[model samples]
Target: MITTSRIRVWDPLVRIFHWSLVAGVAANLFLTEEGGTTHQWIGYGIAGFIGMRIVWGFIGPWSVRWKSFWPTPSRLKQALRPNYTAASSDNITHTTLGAVMMLTLLALLIGLAVTGYMMEETTRFWGVDWVEEIHEVMANALLLLVPLHVIGAIVESIKKHDNLIGSMVHGYRRVQIPPQHMTKHVDDRA
Candidate 1:
């Protein structure tokens, strides 16, 4: 392994949002009764987190901002290249594909929150089949993608010899930066 240095990547708020999202998803999927009060409250909490994340994407430090990892079509292509690495001087945060996954997860969370609220709080859609179907589909989709997200994180962490999981918990990763790629870090973790 190349020599690595500690640098902050995820911020504290980002870390909190991440683990909270995981817990909410897990609780609703495995612990709570469907449409139960606890489930609904967790869903509301998740929606609030997503809303804050979206706002933070605008105002957070450069590494956590949307512009830092906005996976445009062309950008996706670049990210897919065999040699693509997050250690790039220009983009040192989430892998581009990870950004895609993050956006998909957030979108699904929003769908669940809205549909769940409609079913629980509104009379017009209380018995609607389509809304409930949409909600279930999104939740199941999360079941599939959440595992993939975890697997990807594990794979990258091992391949890069960096603790991707721990980075989220504590907001730092030990990364090897080639001399040619050295640049001022964008994150303001301190």
Candidate 2:
């Protein structure tokens, strides 16, 4: 058995935002026809989710805050250290690379949303080639990045010996620490 702490890192809002965003992206990317009302509504919903997440980062729990996992140069260095562990991070919702990817994904989503709105709602950008091009590029970029994000989650799960996907789903994570680091006795025989 592993001595671990069951931490409520993801929280309900975070998990809901995560999975709902995933579904909305999938629906917009595949299920719904582009330029159709359904697709446009989905895009608007995704934009809303992103907006809520950004606000949550400011007022939500410490674990989900920007400062917690912003991947600053110093924090990245610490995460990149050879002896780093999940315990090394004050926030487990993202690794250093995960933080970078999160920011990239958010920017891309915002780009998609803005370009989408421009194409749909504004005369200046409506029917404009460049605006449509940017929207397509952003959607394609999201398609590319989403898979890599999944792979990263799998890799992190293996590396940490924890179920990161489960954490996202259940809003809880079992953060295992080495026996020596524990203040109590453990039976980590395996």
| Global Cα lDDT for candidate 1 | 0.86
Per-candidate Cα lDDT values, in order, are: 0.86, 0.84
**Candidate 1 per-residue lDDT over residues 17-58, each given as its tens digit:** 999999999999999999999999999999999999999999
Error of 1 at 52 (Å): 0.7
Write the residue-wise lDDT of candidate 2 on 1-190 in tens digits.
5457666677789999999989999999989989889998998999999999999999998779898788899878887888887445645568888999889999999999899999998989899999999999989999899999999889888887788898898776677655554432222331
Q: What is candidate 2's TM-score against the reference?
A: 0.86
RMSD of each: 3.2, 4.4
User: Per-residue lDDT for 20 in model 1?
Assistant: 97
